[model samples]
Target: METSVFTRSIESLLDEDEYRALQTHLVENPESGSIIPGSGGIRKIRWGLKGRGKRGGARVVYFWAVRRDRILMLYA
Candidate 1:
């Protein structure tokens, strides 16, 4: 996980709709651990989604980049 990349992603810069979507995800699937691909020029990268609501239920996503360096991060 790249700190800079995770800190600077579209998911990191959640808009009104995106924030609601995340909250919905947390509510719906309260016990799932998964990783989904991130968007916006962040190929070769995947964001980790971990549920921490019920002793690791109800997930949150952390966007990450796969580059060797942190210069490629682009926050939306």
Candidate 2:
């Protein structure tokens, strides 16, 4: 399921290939992102754009829902 914010905002930030790569990375390494303080269990990871490095990339915020075995993508 996709939220309106994700579909409208986040989806437009990346191309199809970049989005797929992000999804694949998340699926393989759910906890790879650094944990954000005071945000419960939320974590943040960087994603580079096609012509940019990770430093010039976007920040993807997500949460690992262990009980449900799901990763909730909160923001980007």
Candidate 3:
């Protein structure tokens, strides 16, 4: 996984298992998130926290580069 300062900061807030699960989910379904308009194709997915349901989960913003098979996780 590629890491940026922003992403690393967000990752710091997640447990190891949560981070791994998120990585696996994105790899398995790159198009899982909804595209953000006017953002050059950035996408956002709502990920559930340990005890929180989807309604209270964190928002993960990312960009999926299909050609390179890379997921640029931007924010959380």
Candidate 4:
């Protein structure tokens, strides 16, 4: 996974455990997120906060680089 785009400020959006969970989920299912229309294959996944449900959670945007076998975490 290429998370260099996820800076300190971005990481702060979620706690350590939440971030780790996101990473694990992405690693296990990189193409599970819904693709964004007209974004050149970018995908988005909803991640719930510790107490909130998916509706009130953050939206993680990423791209699955199939050819490179990598996930490019873009935003959250």
Best by lDDT: 3
Instruction: Identify the leading candidate in terms of TM-score.
Output: 2
lDDT value for model 4? 0.84
When sorted by TM-score, best at the front, the candidate numbers are 2, 3, 4, 1
Residue 2, candidate 1: Cα error in Å is 22
Q: Residue 11 of model 3: what lDDT?
A: 66
Output the lDDT of residue 40, model 4. 98
lDDT of each: 0.39, 0.84, 0.85, 0.84
- Model 4: residues with Cα > 4 Å off, grouped in runs: 1-5
Candidate 4 least-lDDT 10 residues? 1-10
The sequence of per-residue lDDT tens digits that candidate 2 reaches over residues 1-76 is: 3355666657768988888899889989999999999989998999998778889898888888988888888888
Writing each residue's lDDT as its tens digit, candidate 4 over 1-76 gives 5456655435767888888888899989998899999999999999988788999888888999899888888877
Q: Rate residue 54 of model 1 by lDDT.
A: 41
Give TM-scores for every candidate, taking all chains together and pairing residue i with residue i. Answer: 0.29, 0.88, 0.87, 0.85
| Model 3 regions lying over 4 Å from their true place | 1-3
Candidate 4: residue pairs that collide: none
lDDT of 1 by residue, 1-76 (tens): 3245544555544555754665455345432324444544332222233432344322234333335322222322
Instruction: Give the higher-lDDT candidate: 2 or 3.
Output: 3
